[model samples]
Target: MSSRFRLFDRTAVMGSGYIFAMVNRMQMLYYILILPKHLVQPYMIVGILGVGVLSQINLFILAKYLTSNYFVLGYRGFVQLFSEKIVRFFALLGIFFILIKVIVTTLGYVEIVHQFMFPSMKTSWLIFVLMASGFYIASQGMEKTIRLSIISFLATIWVILVYIPYFLPPISEIHHLYPLVPGEVSLHSWYGLLMVWSALSGPEYLVCLGPWIGPKEKILRGMSIGNALSVFEYLVLFVACLLYYGSPYLEKISFPVVNMIRYLQSPVFERVDLILISLNMIYFLYLIALFLLCLYGAIRIVAGRINIKTNRKGFLGSVAAVFICMLIINGWYWREG
Candidate 1:
């Protein structure tokens, strides 16, 4: 029966390269799109760097857990660390966390598509399309979903190069980057730093992929490379925002990174921003699929069905429940602040 639905089956071990791709793509999720508006000061660059260093330290600790003997045992590892009841309790808590993350990420990206790509379209339809894509990818099972990380990374990584024009002369203003250090600090500045820290998250979730990722020794090195590249990307985007819009003007613009992309005048394509925004769907789908699988697994664990075979009805019902939750939130509660 388990062989019939091999969602959690591990046939071959993926290397450190997969780990690198997954970590980098996960950290560079939806938050990066609107980060510049929140971090509206030049000195916040320092905050990014500082938070990045702290994230690296956090990854080091995570590496220890990933490489541990117990991790290779998967669910039994948690059972050994705590008891079966405690593990189930954690899984129960995880269901809520996974749902929240999935809801925010899917709806956030849907809002972008609604505003920019399809202003006339209903946001609920956009959410359904995106969630359906995610469900398809996740249904392929964990190994293939993990493999999608590299494709997601390759597809969106070049979008950063498009921002190069913002950093050059003519478009860039020298004074915008002035006062590299903050003149005065406030609680708002601390909040901006906290955002950076939050952005560097998602790597810790790699603990769940122990059966697929290897060799154990290379895990930390791969994670470090991915983490470093994410920081570098953040620095480039934030600096380009500063140079293009300056600190004062940057605060007023929503989706500064996407807006910067809109300024690029391609001779062939009139709406280059739309094309790139669509390209972003690849990674966004990868994340949603990854989280969807994680959510389902957590559900099974909490339900004490970890040893049972996966069935189409159970999986589809779970995905449908999430889709319904997203619709309810979009219809009632989700308001951009």
Candidate 2:
């Protein structure tokens, strides 16, 4: 039971891991990189500013609500009986949410990779690599994930800063942003943005980490830093994509961020998008590990309170096995679809 609690403590760090994972797995290959072929640049500006803004706010609210109720109060307050029950319920719900998200992301990534990078590679191989990496990281637990996240986040910032000059020259006009908000934002777009934003909630990763953290204040501080990092990363990436490609191009590209950076040419460098892709891949790997940790945590909470006996290694391995199986099934489905 105590080890189960420990796992949840670490998962709280991995909750927000999906954001970076999404950026790499879904956003890069599918949208931005493909933008120039379909849409121009102006429409993308519209989508990013309009849809992106609403999405962040919506996701923040959802994160705040869910994090407070499930991770912070319910699971973290392990000593309390009432909190335990609430935590268990929310843990299951979180598992369901993450599973759905992982499936959709896996499908989207498959499409992106199939279209962009490796048309020749079988999707199952990709899944295997992803699962292998995910399992390796999940086995390490939360501390390494958190530490690695900090490093990845820092490294990406340096990469962006180093490459900033190339993108500076082709700055598009703000008048391109003329009609800011459309007639009315649709519910579907709103939902999309909300999903994007909710995708940033990383505190759920902390569920696996709570016990490891000595002081309550330290956990709060970590959550603050992690969430802030997520918001800032999204904002910077969104702005970079919008500024480089504009809204017109955004509507066309499958992954705007990668496309925005791909064409970057200097005397020294030809294609910066390659570097960005590598960096994003690192981030995504870290994020996937985080999600696995979170799933492991959630399962532990439910299993423990229910008096199901399972060791921590057994529990984590079981969850990873399940996730990998799901990824395989999803990959094959999308292959046929």
Candidate 3:
């Protein structure tokens, strides 16, 4: 007998812990790896905190929607609110957004892996291997894919502690954090604030997972904690970068966080940075899998087949289409920003 493909099947309602893990991990995507280089000014530390507060307020509004009776209804809830036609239209728009996110995120990480981990390897093979891993994880169904979030969180969160050495004397300079206030603000400073806001944006996507997320009362608490943690991680990272490289030197580094990891020396492990990068893959794969599943669901909704039984061919075809798009963009359009 052939197995049935049920991409959105929800066997269990996940608690706030899952929500917390997912939100935290989503906010800490590939962008966080390169954020410090963009917001190199020490005064931008204030931007990080300010944007984090704004993100919290936004999450408050989002929590209202998530807690409503309509939210748990999932697709039907959206249909009731916007009508089937409008919901379909929204799903249509979602397809493009999801595609761009998956493409950019996957390709960005592939470039990192290519540059840092395997410079000798072709980028195309790296993309294939990563997507295949994601496809296999996503094939397990939404619940399992979501359950992987906690694992992803735990596996990589400890890496933050590795940066502690950067905070101490020999590697760090007290004067590097001086002049924490900006004397004259410019367009570049505002741009840095916007980047910080953008970095904290992944929680908004949680609105779509209403059916799986639970304990409506605790949703806000979970999300708030997650958002707070993301900000703290951002602060820790940016400060460490400043202490280690200072604002002027930080501006020149491409991947400041990854480069900082390279500075550490371990007796047993020849390449500690490589090990951390590999561990980072757990969350990267988790997110790619989650988005792949989301993309397939969006495709189904757009095709007016939300109720239809999912088949392997349709699912594989959607993933393949995305893979091809990645290949095309990587080959022709992708440029290092």
Comparing 2 and 3 on lDDT, the stronger one: 3
Which residue segments of model 1 deviate by more than 4 Å? 1-3
Least lDDT summed over 10 consecutive residues: which range in candidate 2? 22-31
In model 3, the number of clashes is 0
Ten residues in sequence with the least summed lDDT for candidate 1: 1-10
lDDT of 3 by residue, 8-89 (tens): 8878899999999999999999888889998888888888999999999999999999999999989899998889989889
The reply for model 2, stretches above 4 Å from the true place, is 1-76, 79-87, 104-115, 162-167, 181-189, 218-229, 266-269, 305-320, 332-337
Cα RMSD (Å) per model? Answer: 1.2, 6.1, 1.0
Model 1 compared with the native: what TM-score?
0.98
Output the lDDT of residue 211, model 3: 90
Candidate numbers sorted by lDDT from highest down: 3, 1, 2
